[model samples]
Target: MLIDILTQRCNAQRLMIAEAYQSMYGRDLIGDLKEKLSDHFKDVMVGLMYSPPSYDAHELWHAMKGAGTEENCLIDILASRTNAEIFQMQEAYCLQYGSNLQEDIYSETSGHFRDTLMNLVQNIYKGKPVLILQGIREEGYTDPAMAAQDAMVLWEACQRKTGEHKTMLQMILCNKSYQQLWLVFQEFQNISGQDIVDAINECYDGYFQELLVAIVLCVRDKPAYFAYRLYSAIHDFGFHNKTVIRILIARSEIDLMNIRKRYKERYGKSLFHDIKNFASGHYEKALLAICAGDAEDY
Candidate 1:
């Protein structure tokens, strides 16, 4: 009954049903599914039943649990989300695990990767301007002078003999509105004669480099950023299914069509083709459904 309803209902409705089941039965809906289902179906059902924050927290838990950390999972959840979304997940992580998400990430990882994740998860509750792409389109950029100043600050930060200024970089990335950052990036290119990604790559190393580059790409073009992420996740020695599922599910409604286009342009293969090749069975079917398109020829 749960599986049928879950497969048929939308995510919001399914969440409602899960809550109803828990309230009525006195057992967690996810716990029941774990008992009743097996394999990929179980994973899908359980994923579907979770509230987005709970699901993210659960993924973060598994990613950090054991001998090695799943850095990609951390990037996917921590890097891709908006500030408001991060705050909610932080709360959920604490509520679910009785521990701080930021501290947990720090304990599980080290150095630049830990710093990058910490920057993302902290200060998320601070009031920042809310602006989606469409909102930016409608409102346009407000401050060109500030953007130029920020661009200069970023250049100096990157140019320092030791390394980029951690606090300054974090402050700019965290505090600036997305729209403002978009302008800042353009100004950065104009002033530095190199894209931020190139500068980051030249100056930094390891996951910190990757994280900063991801932030720039996301600010410049989110769909393309995700497209690059999706490609790297699948085109590697072994496909990272967790990354694949997370990206597909997270962006299914937002800009996946654009992501698909970017993927084909960047990788010379369709995302659907990659999905069909890397995944199989119900998992494949579920991914293709969320993708909302058919496979394409290479």
Candidate 2:
């Protein structure tokens, strides 16, 4: 019943429904649902109630709230979002929590990896304006000479001291445009006889390494990056519900249609099949609703 109603209503419709329920019953709709729903299914229902930015803000709060940080959540949200989206999340975080998102993240994390996430959320990098390729339609402009120089820089960075390398990778990965990075990636391979992903794997460890790899993959193919995340959540970690929920719900109206195709191509099975197999009951139904498109396995 909950699945049927939510699956049928868009966010606006859901809000209207909430208002009608409140007026008719003289009780808060969300509060009632919260009291009733449990586990990941509850999370899905509640998440469906918030706007995307609001939901993201809530996730970041919870991620940073406990003693330890959910670094993957930070990386996934901060690194993958556009400058505009980050700004929106920043505002939402402030409005929802009455706290600065950067300060929250700052207190929770430290060192080079923290700085990279800061640059992303704070847009704090000074000097020359970095082209934001996350949401804009590229003019398809890329400088071959500049890419070669940057590629050489990365190769050289790999040889330098650890501090120097972290600084270099942070600058290149965070500031450069997508097309620029794509060219630099190819050049890096040609000059070094190794993939950039492999280079990061060789040089770095911890959250820093993971974030850099995620950035490279996102630049290469955002949907495919997400598809791989889904695969890991579903298979490698035994239906990591929060990760699955975040990706599917957040990307549903964005690039999920493409992500579905990429998942099938990469995994030799449909995302729907995997979700159906791994997740159960209303939880599976909710995820499938977000994932719904084609019925056939690829």
Candidate 3:
């Protein structure tokens, strides 16, 4: 069956099969699958068909399309992705939707959240001398004095009593390298007697607060941030399986291993245990496969 084959085939093999299916039947494979399948099975199959960038763009579209914005989706895609990944998604968004990703995000979001998203989508990162495929850096802070200065700049940006200069905050968070910002965060805590995240929470409200917190957490510990996101996605009011699938699939090759370890350490249970509890059927099988294996105890 198509469903069975889809669940079993690798992405490349699936792409080939999709091509063959369309050639043979003169119908798009996803269209045919949608016609035949229902519910989550259909969802997973369709999700699998998209090349990664297209998949990222499609997720962004769905996140912004409805009445309410899915801020978690926005943060996950915008906050956690590498510079090259974001660049690819922006291109894919324009190509697929015939609109600029940045312009669409600006229209959908407002204030500091929008500011942060706009800067993040630009995919600008600095201080890397070597050419990397995805523009992810392996470098750390190079100047202590610069870090301290940036730290004070960040503290002043958020610590204002009358008005929080969110532009300055966004500039520091968006433009600074993660390694540089990590030092800045540590220095900010020393200077302000509060963590930058705590400062953001106290000074700001709504999606802006959430976006800044996500950025700070991402800089501090990426795997930990994702682990927490996965837990929240599954444990929230209604099951957020879409988030679970998106995060799992997107991070599978990148840092799922680290995420799994951090999730287990933080949540007192393995990600595999949680996934099994929350998901099932062929869809669950596909997720578990991407996860590589179950928990050590499981």
Candidate 4:
């Protein structure tokens, strides 16, 4: 049905696709998206599909093949999507694969990347609203003075040469709610007269710092940073494949439209043009579809 919808140029095709899927399958069209698409199209469709976690291990297996591991694609797909989508994807993955997506990723990837992605996937798939509420309450409820001291301790640990603090920071950034962390970030800035993210950057390096920066920049001003990422990945960084895939796959559904606008404003050229110049094959097609702002089509 999504393929049929995409074949036509009707303005109502997206709604038609949605209605057709819901009526026929008793499920959302995102599942169909997984079945019907590949490369950047799959990425964009997954973004717009928005079912309660409807992507399965088979679809994930296919997407993660070729030049990248399914593990990495799973992390990118799950991390970029909303929590509701993640939960639904987890359910679908477990049902179809006979194993949890989280468990599969844990087994497949290793080190801090694996750990950070697992923590994020777990939080999203947990189906617990109170976890977020509890995190928000943590510093305020358990003695403010003690909470402040503990936060300082955490910060100090982050500054140490050993990686334990870095691990803790990754866990915090990956697992904590952005809303909750926003408040904590504000408090940290108030105390130190500098952004907590800036402090983290000063203290860390390599992939650890990259992940930290991704989270902080995402939280601070996602669109602008994405614009910068797109620009840097294509022009400054000489079309780094992983970076290009990561930014495009991550933003296609949520903020590609904004990123496109920013790209035009920043570079005096459309992002679509730059993407075309730098990328090819199915990946380029998918990115073009997303930049065109018609992601609902499969």
Candidate 5:
């Protein structure tokens, strides 16, 4: 039914069905949406459905007040979506709601978390190999193969069980290109039957360890890993503050609820509860709104 509504060319038809479904059923049409769609079209529909009510100060204020903030939902919707859709959503969000989506997200989120999410939303390919090449060039290493080899070794350590090796891998993972890192990830997975994340958990410990593992897993199979990270950061890690902030802020616009469900299943805790406990300030509030899983944007 949700897909049927979304696939309609007429805006009135889509909105009418969506509003009617919400009114009569006393349930969000979005919750019913996942089962109705798949792939890029799902991405488009979900983004449109999960857009915040307004990107203006009033919406932010309401978000701050914990009434319909929809930050996590926005993040998941945006993150899983393609750059083109995000760009379109941003345009529509501003035109219809009278607010800039990027500015609003910037207002609601901060730090490296904000940076990473924004980078994604902007469709900045920071993860591309050219960025890695640039970094290598800055290091006075002209040979791509040499740089590639070093990157692979770091990735290898991230996969292997050696403490020193893992540490080295973590540094590279944190600093290197998502593009380069992604290649390295593919290489590592191919070389080892075990996933890199599994290797990280087996060999490393602590917040950094978890963060590194999260990044690895997110890069590997984003929806699945993010689902798990959202759960752990909120429920078990004492909100670990940073981790919750990092994952939520980074992925809120990306594929978080999928992460949320995975978190719920694996941890047996509500994703919202963890956010309520660990998150504080505007940031926390925004994330909580996101996890509630409303699909208003599409």
Candidate 6:
């Protein structure tokens, strides 16, 4: 019943349910579920209780909390989200934690990688919503000249003096629309004869390059990139339950079907199959439920 309710309801509906549950019982749904349930099942249920932005902000806090940072969590969220989404997540972060998300990120991270994340998340701080939110999708205007120019700038960053590389790359990646960025990536390949991901791998190391690679992969094919992330999360012969739960829940409404298709294409097996093989019990059942309605194996 829990699985059915969470899996069947839209996020808004689920939030209503959580609210109703709280009002009726005088207890928080997530808190009760945490007390009753254990392990990943609790995680899935609790995650379902929050709205998407709250959940994202929650993930971000956890990513930056404690002894060390989970750089992948930061990269996965900040790199892939649209500017509008980031803005909402930032607001939610502030509301939930009573601290500025950007400041926390700045204090937690350092150097070029920190700078890149700040750039990606800077739109909200500027007191204006980005163009993407104001219906850029229906128009999606891509300028080839601009793309080529941006491509040259990126090439210079890779080939030229070391000091300016991060600025050049993050400026374009953080600001461009996905359509324009795609064109820029094509121009980059034409000028450099190397994939941008490959170039980043060559030119930078540590989390700086990792963030760039994630952005490039996300720009080119988000579902494919997510599929790879899902694979990477579980295929290490160890259960990365946090990453798997995060991706499955976060992308459930957004693009799970497309991600499922890409996963099969890339791995020669269904995501359902992989989950069954790699995870078990109600934890697996919860994942499979969000992933329900389509599990046809290739």
- Per lDDT, the best of the predicted structures is 6
Model 2 residue pairs with clashes: none
Which parts of model 2 are misplaced by more than 4 Å? 19-26, 124-141
Per-residue alpha-carbon lDDT of candidate 6 for residues 222-282, written as tens digits (9 for 90 to 100): 9999999999998973878889899988999899899999998989989888889987888
Ranking by lDDT: 6, 2, 3, 1, 4, 5
lDDT of each: 0.75, 0.83, 0.79, 0.60, 0.52, 0.85
- For 1-298, candidate 1 gives per-residue lDDT tens digits of 4444665566788778777887898878888888987776567767877777787888898889857988877876776677666767877888998988878888988875676677677643335543432111112345889989988888887888243575576557655677888888899999999988888789777777777777777767889999988888888747777778777766765688999999989888788888889888777777776677743433
Pick out the ten consecutive residues of candidate 1 with the lowest summed lDDT.
130-139
Write down the TM-score for model 5.
Answer: 0.38
lDDT of 3 by residue, 178-203 (tens): 88887888899899999888888988
Query: Candidate 5, residues 1-298: lDDT per residue as tens digits?
Result: 3333443323345556668889999877666665666543343454445333222222233342464344544443433443344555555666665766667667776544454445544522445533221221122113445445755675566557465675566455544545556666655666666666676677666544545555666455677876665665556656544345445544555566677767667776667765656655544444554454443311
Instruction: Pick the TM-score winner.
Output: 6
Give the Cα error of residue 119 in candidate 2, in Å: 1.1
The residue pairs that clash in candidate 4, if any, are: 52-88, 53-88, 53-89
TM-score of 2: 0.90
Q: 3 or 6: which has the higher lDDT?
A: 6
The lDDT, on a scale of 0 to 1, for candidate 3 is 0.79
Q: In candidate 3, how many Å is residue 242 off?
A: 2.0
In each prediction, how many residue pairs overlap at the backbone (N, C-alpha, C within less than 3 A)?
0, 0, 0, 3, 27, 0
